[model samples]
Target: MDKIIYAILISNDRQDELTRLLSGIRGISDSNLFNITYNDISVVASDFSSNKIIVDKEFAIDYARVIEDLAQHFTLLPVRFGTLMESPDAINEILIKYYDEFKQNLQKVENKYEFSLKVLWDYEKCSGKIRLKTESEDQNAAKLFHNNSVSTEYLLKKIKEHRFESALLEHVEQLIGEISTRLAQLNPIHKFQKMVTPNIILDAVFLLEKHKKDEFIQAIDHLKSQHDDLNFLLTGPWPPYNFVEITLK
Candidate 1:
C-alpha cells in the first residue's frame, strides 16, 4: 500500500501527544492516521491505494482536513495534496534527506498562522473617479503625442488605456502602503498581489502570531471602516500554507 503523506511535523517531545491526536482524527476516506517518526521530525500518513482512491474534490478536502487537524496540535509543514510514497522506507529516507530544511521551515512558522485578505471595489464607480483625476494628465499625453506628429485615434486610445492601468496600479500601491503601515505594529510577515482584477484590487496574506489573531481582525475592521468604498474579505488563522518554501523532488 502507498502512504499518503499529509504533513511533516516537529515531533520533538510531543511524540505521545501526537500519537493520541492522530488516533482521533481520520485520514482521507476515513483511513487510520499514523505517524512515521524520524528523530525529532515526523510524517503524518495513511495507507492508500492511488488506483483505488478517487482523486477528486471531496478526497482533497478530506486530505486537507487531516493536515488542518494536525496543524492545530503541531507546528507542521503541510505536504502538498496528493503526496504519496511507495513504502515506509521511502518516506523515512526522504525525511532523513530533508530533515534540516523541514526543521528550519517548522521553526520559522512555529506559533504563526496564515491569514488572507481580499480587497474589492465597485470597478465602474472607481474608474469614474480615476478618470476625473486623469483628465489633466490625458491632456498632457495628447500634447506630447501631438508634438511628435504621431497623433492617431488608435494611439490616443492606447494612451488612455495605458494611463488608466498606471493610475489603477498606483492606487493599489498606495492602498497597500497604507495597509502595511497600519499592520506594521503587529509585525507579521506579509505578501501582496495587487489588481488581480478591476474589481478585486488587492489580495494579501499575512503570517501572524497565533496569539494576535484578534488584534489582526480588529485592525482589518478598522481599515474597512476607513475605506467605505472598498470591501474587505478576511479569512484565516490557517496552517502556514503561504509561508512554506520547500521542494523535494
Candidate 2:
C-alpha cells in the first residue's frame, strides 16, 4: 500500500508520542493514522490502498484542515496537499534526509502564524475617476487628429492609452505603498502582489508572531474604515503555508 503523508512534526518525545497522536487521530479512507520517525522528527501518515479514496481539491483542503487542527498543539511542516510514499521506512528515510531543513523551517514558524489580506477595489468606480481626470486631455488630443496625419492620430491615440494606463498603475502603486508602509512597522515579513485582478488591487500575505495577530487585525480594520470605497477581506491565523520555504527531495 502507498503511504499518504500529512505533516512532519518536531517532537522530542519521539516515537511514543507520535504513535499516541496517530492513535488518537484518523487518516483518509478511515485508515489508521500512523507515524514514521527519524531521530526527533515524525511524519504523520497512513498506509493508502490502491482502491484508495483519491484526494481531490475538497479532500486536500480537508487534509489541510486536519493538519491545521494538529498545528495548534504541535510544531510541524505542512506537506503541500499531496506528499505520499510507499512505506513507513521510506517516510522515515525522508525524515532523516530532510531533518535539518525541516527543523530549520519549523523553528522559524514555531510561535508564529500567517495571515492573508486581499484588498479589492471597485474597478468601475476607479476607472470612472481616471476617465474624468483625463477627459479634457482626451478631448484636446482628439481635436488634433486629421485624415491627412495618420501618424499624428496614431501617436495621439497611443498617448491617450499611455496616459490612462499610467494613471491607473500609479493609483495602484499608491494604495499598495500606503498599506506596505503601515505593515512595515509591524516588522512582519510580507509578500505583496499588485493588480492580481482588475478588481483586486492588492493581495498580501504576512508572517507574524502569533501574539501580534490582534494588532494585524486592528491595522486592517483601520485601513477598511479609512478606505470605505474598497473592500478588505482578512482571513486566517492559518498554518504557515505561505511561510514554508523548504522543499523535500
Candidate 3:
C-alpha cells in the first residue's frame, strides 16, 4: 500500500500526545492516521492504494480535512493532496533530506493562521463613473487636434481608452496602499492579487498571529464600513495554505 502523506509537523517531544490525537481523526477513505517521526519532526500519513484512489473533489476535501485537523494540534506544513510514497523508508529518506527546510517553514507558521479577504465592487457602475470622468477630460485634449481625419479620431479614442485603464489601475493601487498602511501595525505577512476579476478588485491572503485574529477581523470590518460601495468578504482562521513556500522533492 502507498502512504499518502498529509502534513509534516513539529512533533516537539509530543509523540504520545500526537498518537492519541491521530487515533480519533480519520484520513482519506476512513483509513487510520499515523505518524512517521525523525528527530523532532513527524509526517502524518495513512495507507492508500494509489491505483484505486478516486481523484475527485470528495477525496481532496477529505485530504484537506486531515491536514486541517492536524494543524489544530500541531504546527504543520500541509502536503499537497495525493502525495504518495512506496513505503515508510521513502518517507524517511525525504524527512532526512528536507529536515531543515521543513523545520524553518514550521517555525514560520508556528502560531499563525491564514485569512482571505476579497474586495468586490459593481464593475459596471464604477467603470461608468471613471469613463465619464475620463471622457470629460479627453474633450479638452480633443480640441487640440483640429484635423478631424478618420485616423486622428481613432487615435484619440484609443488614447481615451488607455487613460481610462491607467486611471482604474491607479485607483486599485491606492486602495491596496491604504489597506497595507492600515494593517501595518499588525505586521502580517500578506499576498495581494489586484483585479482578479472585474468585480473582484482585490484577492488577498494574510498570515497573522493566531491571537490577533479578532483584531484582524475588526480591522476588516472598519475598512468595510469606510467603503460602502465595495463588498468585503473575509474568510478563515485556517491553516496557512497560501503562506507555505516549500516544494517537496
Maximum-lDDT candidate: 3
Q: Estimate each model's TM-score.
A: 0.94, 0.90, 0.96
> How far does residue 125 in candidate 2 sit from its true spot (Å)?
0.7
Ranking by lDDT: 3, 1, 2
Whole-model lDDT values for every prediction: 0.89, 0.82, 0.90
Q: Which of the two candidates, 1 or 3, achieves a greater TM-score against the reference?
A: 3
lDDT of 3 by residue, 124-169 (tens): 9988888888887888768768899998999888888899999889
* Better-scoring candidate (lDDT), 1 or 3: 3
Better of 2 and 3 by TM-score: 3
Q: How does model 1 score by TM-score?
A: 0.94
Residues 16-119 of candidate 2: C-alpha lDDT, one tens digit per residue: 75676677776766678876667777788877775747658867766876688678778887887767798888887788888889989989888888899999
Estimate the Cα RMSD of every predicted model relative to the unseen true structure. 1.7, 2.3, 1.3
TM-score order, best first, reads 3, 1, 2
RMSD of 1: 1.7
- Candidate 1 has its poorest 10 consecutive residues by lDDT at 142-151
Return the lDDT, model 3, position 80.
Answer: 76
Error of 3 at 226 (Å): 0.8
